[model samples]
Structure formats: C-alpha cells, structure tokens
Target: MTASPALRPSAFTDAELIGSGRRVAEIEAQALQSLARRVDGSFAAACRLILASHGRVVCTGMGKSGHVARKIAATLASTGTPAFYVHPGEAGHGDLGMITDKDVVLALSYSGESDEVLMLLPVFKRQGNAIVAVTGRAQSTLAREADVHLDVSVEVEACPLDLAPTSSTTASLAMGDALAVALLEARGFTADDFARSHPAGSLGRRLLLHITDVMHAGEDVPQVSEEATVSEALVEMSRKRLGMTAVVDAQGRLSGLFTDGDLRRMLDDTVLDLRNTRIGTLMTRNPKTIDARQLATEAARLMETHKISGLIVVDEERRPVGALNIHDLLRARVV
Candidate 1:
C-alpha cells in the first residue's frame, strides 16, 4: 500500500525571519571586531611584501575563500596594487605557470589545510617566492609554511548549523581589505591615479574631464558685441543653437548674457523693435562664468546652483572663450 504524504511545515513569520538575520549580522560584526585586535606585525609584513613586489600579487584559495580571494585581488588592483586571483584547483592543472619568483602569493584558508593550496607550497619553495597566508588555524601546515601569517580565527560561525563558513570568511575578507588599504597608503595612491584606472566610471568623468573638453569653442560660441542690435543677437543665438548669446564689451570682454527667456520677457512689452534695440540694454549684467581649465563637474554644480542651462568659459582676462549647456555635459557623460 502507498504511504500517506508527510505534512508540510509552517512558514516562518516575518518577525522570526528578521530576528534570525539580525543574529547572523551581529555574530559576523562581532567576529570582525575581534579580528581587529589581532592585527600585529604579521599583517604589516604582508603589506610590506605586497608593496615591495615588482610583479603582480597572485591571490589563491579554495571554495568560499576563493570568492573572497577574487574580491581582494580586484580591490588590490583597483587601488594600485597590481593583483590577480589564481584558483588552486586550476593551478594543479596548468595555472601554476602564472606564479613567478617576482610575484607574491596571498593564500586564504579557514582550516589552513586545503590540499589544493598545500600542494602548491613545494612549487613556491622551489621558486623562492614569498607567501602570505590568511588563515584561522595559526598552527596549520599552511600557516607554518607562510612567510607571513594573518590570523582570522573566529570562535563561532554565524551559521545555525555551525558547519558553514560565515564568521571565518568575513574575518578573512576584512583582513584582505586591511592588507589592500595598507599597501595603497604605502604606495601613495591618489584619487587621480584611481580615476585613470576607472576612466569609464562616473568618478573618472568627474575628476579627469575639463570644461574645455566639453565646451563649444571658436565660432560655435554664441556671442554679440554690446552695441549689436537685438535682431543680430537673436540671429547669432539661432545660428549657434545654444539658446543664449554672450554680450561682450569693446575689448571683447564679457559684459552680460541674453537668453531665450530674456526675449520672451521683452516681447511682452506694448511695442518692441528687435532691429534697433541694443543687446546691452536688456541683457543681464555680470552673468555666470567659469574658467576653461576647471573640472566639468564644477560646471555642472554651477549650472545646478544657478538654475541656468548654459555657461561661458572665460580666460584670465574674463574674455569669452567657449560656451556649453546641460546637453553638452549629458553628451560628455559628465551629467
């Protein structure tokens, strides 16, 4: 005879689920706090080894530790520490060739007895390469063989089953960040250096892009002499398509600005003569201006704060050299 189906268990309440999550976070946070106090000479030695290495930092690990190892490698490389992750499982096949005497190997293991990683120790020894190990077991074979060992031992895992690697992995990741940051500081890595590596990112655009790079220079700039008629200024604005025109003095120095809104306000009058009206009579005096060499991000902020759509780039003598609008910033990917 067929057996009756087993009853399904009730789902956990929201309060119960949230409580479990909080408990896990608290445990992991406490583990990191404990790991902070254990930072000693060995950590410094690891940083020094990576900083002095002429070649890239080769990070390796197995399983969960391998994931954290990849992240550490990325952080190191991004912060000017030249690094790459090598999988121990793959190293035994052919990836071991990636490691060299000039490179430093950073290994991560919770038990410090990962056979895949331990198997590469002999190769590292034969090549005379330095090995920095981040592990929980200080007396494990991997730790004992390392040139520098960073202790990331945790008393308990955040896992309710007590078998998963939760707390230990967090500690290892924290230690990796500590190493990367220390090496970054030692190498004197700057924001400009970072921007160069991440030129496709928003931070790179903000830091490396100049106003002149995104502005319309030469004849593209809409402008009219202070004595030019309103009709002439409108024609220049229409031809340039910037929706605005700069009013300059006899010396070609910027004196005022006339925008499309200005024309609309002037048209509200009982009668207006665009051909006979001088631009300087109705232009806003002492308009906003920015230096050509300034950062494009600064231009964005200026436009935002002033609620204007365009700006005039000026030289040392306050002469109009270029003009730009919000659309230019958008096109340059600086917005």
Candidate 2:
C-alpha cells in the first residue's frame, strides 16, 4: 500500500496569522475612510429629512443587515431621535401599518436586491414616506427606488472565502453610528437629555437625583451642641451610625464636625477629659457642606476631594438639614 502523506508542521508560524489579521484591518480601515469621503451634501440632506419629520425613523432590513438596523434604531431613539426597527419579512405580515406618511424609512441590504425589501418600496412610495437606502450597490433595485441612497460599499469581504458579510456589515454599522452622532450634535442633545432617556441608568442617578433625595433628613440627622462634651458627641455619633456628628451653635447653624478619625487622633495624643472638654475644642471647624439641592454626584466629589467619608447637608440659612455618607451614595447608585 502507498504510504499516506505524513502530517508535518510547516515553517510558516504565528507571524502569518498576525499578518493576515493586519491586512484585514488595513482593508476595513480603507473602506471606512472611503465612506467618510462619501459624506457630502447628501449626508446633511439625510439628517435634515429625518430631523424635519414629525414621525419616527422606521428601520428595516434582512439577515445581518437587519441586526445592524435594529441597533441603529435603538441608538437613534436613545439619542433624542425617535426610531424603531421593523423586519421586512414581518412588514409583509401586518407590520407595514407601522409606517405612515410622516415617518421616514431607513432600509438596509448589502446586495440592495432583497426581494422582501423591494416589494415594500412601492407601498412606502405610495404612502408618501421618504425612503433612505444603505447598500453596496447604488444601481440595485432598492437603491434605485429609494429617495436617498447611502453608498456603504466595501473593497472586499473580510472572509477568506469572499462569500460572507464581514467588512460590509462593519462598514454599515459604522455608517449608522456616524449618522446617529451627527444628528445628536445637530439636535444639541445634552447630557441632561440623555439622562432623561435613561432614567434607570447610573448617569441618571448622578445627574437627576438631588442631594436631598438620598440624605438622611429630620430625626436621622445627628446633631450636638458646640458646648456639648466630647462624650455626648460620641454618643450622638453612635446613635446616628454615620461615623460623625455635627456640632451646632445656639442658632442651630453648623459650627463644626466630630468624626471617628478625630477620636482616633485624640486617642493617639493623650486621654482627654471627656467630661470637661467641649466637642468644639476637638471638632473640625467650618466643615465642608453641600446644599440639599445640589446633585448627588457633586456631593460625592466633594467628599472625595476633601478625603472625608461624610457631609452635612445644609439649607440656605446654613443650618444642618440632613446628612449623607459614602454608603448612602453607594446605596443610591450615585457613586
């Protein structure tokens, strides 16, 4: 019997794999760069069309392009632009009603020849809806029927077999991101606006929630007179469980603060006459404070900047109204 060809490792090594990866990177980079150059008057016109529309941006596609369309719709919606995705196959089965005259349609197809997508073009046109097409073939049926065509053609597929949608999908996704960002800039979408869109997110807690929302109010605020003994202040701190107690004057304004760190320092120096020593003698004078109306994130920063764990929340009259610590911020998800 003829000897089977011996299996042997070639001299070709890791460098070849890395080199192939670099080549693919270079090609995709070039494709994106070409896409950037294609952003001309048409890009601005597309933004204007969507911005002026009263209805939502209805995004639709097939296969991988459909996945990209869904993501783009989500991004646009979250960035102050109303948008939603409609699968082309589903559109034929009753989803077509989602599109109205006021809506603008964004259709994605790599070959620009998806039958389901083409079938809906006449309906969209008859409804008086504006259609924007993202495709590799500008001359394809979908593109030819569209009111505006965005060319997202790539030089070649990243797949070695040249059969899969790889670089094309990346380019399309990047283009969609570019559109979202451009519209965001044009609409002057601020961080506050983004916070409103994501009220349950961390950014919302940091931006929208005030210090009063998380601070301990009423009986929870630990307070002691300036003339009170150190022992009395310590008892108040223990009762409040905030690691500190505010020392107030006869006028009920904050005068100083006594913290656990202060107690430790006092212990290291010498035993104080707790009964005779006033809390004001050992407290930190003019302690850093925050307004109740201030953002919780600002309160957190103040604590970090001063290297302190807690702060006394005060009103316009400089009276202690509440108390907050790092733990409160953590619990509130503002940190």
Candidate 3:
C-alpha cells in the first residue's frame, strides 16, 4: 500500500489570485483619480441641466452600460433626483413616447457609438430635450451630439484580455455616483428625505419611528404607586411582562423604577420579605427615561448607554405614559 499526498481544490497559486486582484484595483483607482482631475465645466453643466429640468432625468444605455445606468438612476432617485432608466433598444420600439421635451436624457456608452443609443439622439434633439453623454471616446457621435459630455475614459480595461467592459463600467458607475452625490448635496437632501424614499429599510425605521410609535402606552405600561408593596409591584411587572414597573408618586408622576434585579437584590437581604417590603424603598430613584416624541434610535442609544434593556416613556410633566424594552425596539427594527 502507498500513501498519497493530500489534494487541494485550487489549481492556481495564491500569488496569481492576489496579483490579479491588485492589478484590477490599481487600474480602477487610477482611472477614478484621472476622472476626478478631468471633471470641469462640463460636469457642472450636466448637474445644472438636471437641476433645471422640469421633468425626470431619463438615463439610457446598452448592455453592461445599461446595468450601470439603471443603478445610477436608482441612486439618483433615492438621493432626491427625479430619475429613471429607459432601455435604448426599446426607445425606438414605442418606449420613446416616455421621453418628453421637458425631461433630460443621460446617455451612456463606452465607445460613444452604440447604434441603439445614437438612434435616439436625433429624436431627442428634434424635441428640444437636453442630452448628457457619459462615454470613453470624447470625439464620438454621442459625445459631439450631447449638450454636456462627462468623460469617463480609462487607459486600459481591468480585464486581462481587454475585451470585457471592466474598468470602463467601473469608471462610468463611479462618475454617475459622483454626479448623483453632487446633486444630492446641492439639493440639500437630508436623511429624512432619503428615508422617505426607502420607507421599508432599517434607515427609515431609525429616522421616522418615534418612541410613541413602538412603546406600550396607557394601562399596558407596568406601573406601581409609591405606597405599593414589592409583591404588588411584582404583580404589575408580571402582568405587563416587561420585567419592570414604573413607580409613580401620588400625583402619578414618575418617581422611580423597580425591576426584577431589584427584587433579587432585596431577596439577598435575608431580613427583607417581598410581601412586606415597600417598592419605594428598593426602587431606583429618578431612573433614565425618554420622551414619547423622541426618536426610537435615541431610546436604543439610551438603553445601550445605561446598560439597561428597558425604558419608561414620560410626558412633559415627567409622568410615565408608556413603556418599552430592548425586545420592543428589536421588534420595531429600531435597535
């Protein structure tokens, strides 16, 4: 019997993989740097065109460029620019009706001579629509015909064979991002506005959700009067299932908070009896609280900073009006 050497899955050396990755990254980074230096009056003109347009910005491209254009449109739309992607191939097949003179057309092509994209230029010009071209060839038909041209030329493709649209696509996407971000800043787009565009996302929950939206209010809030015994507090805590009770003064204002941990501590004193102990004696005085109108993110931060899992929501008069715990925040996706 002979022993065999252990077999590995890969046929290529680690050095080969690392070298290819580094080369691609270096080429892309250099391309971005070059584009940044070349951005001039034309880039500003493109931004102003979109800002001044009375209708949506129509982004169009073909093949891989189309994919990048779609993403760019989404980023622009989410960041406050009214934009959408229209396939150049479909534009001549009746989708052309989607474009109007009031809208601006942003056409993207690596070679700047995509027949499908160029076919729509005449129609756009006839309708008095503004055209912004993003292309690698500065002198191509698309560039010459556009009202504004954003040059995204790359000296070489990240693809080793130089046949695939690798670095070209990266440059185009990055340039699109630059444009969208510049417009976003100029429009004074805020986080709240971004959240509105992404209402189903976690960012929306953090930005739009208030404590009152997720907190248990009214009778659902576990509470005990200052005169209540520890046993009575335990009943309220158990009934509410929050593991804690807000202890209020005779005027119904928040005086303190008592939690299961407090009960445990009281039990540790052999002389104390839960049934006979007053909750006021063992409750934590002036516990941390949040306003009902405060953002849920603030509540999450308060709970995290105070090393507690729950919070009592109070009114302007310092009266306990609601209750929430880490679980509530987790359920709301605010934590």
- TM-score for candidate 2, please give it: 0.87
- Give the local distance difference test score of model 2: 0.91
> Candidate 2: deviation at residue 165, Å?
1.9
Q: Report the C-alpha lDDT of model 3 over 176-230, residue by residue, as the tens digit.
A: 9999999999999998898888888887898899998999998899999999998
Over 78-181, each residue of candidate 1 has an lDDT whose tens digit, in order, gives 99999999999999899988888999999999999999999999999899889999899999999999999999999999998889999999999999898888
Q: Looking at model 1, which ten-residue stretch has the lowest summed lDDT?
A: 1-10
Which predicted model would earn the best TM-score? 3
lDDT tens digits, residue span 224-316, model 2: 998999999988999999999999999999998889999999899998998889998899999999999888999999989989999999998
C-alpha lDDT values of all predictions: 0.93, 0.91, 0.92
List ranges where model 2 is wrong by over 4 Å.
1-26, 201-204
Model 1 pairs in collision: none
Off by over 4 Å in 3: 1-10, 201-203
What's the TM-score of every candidate structure? 0.88, 0.87, 0.90
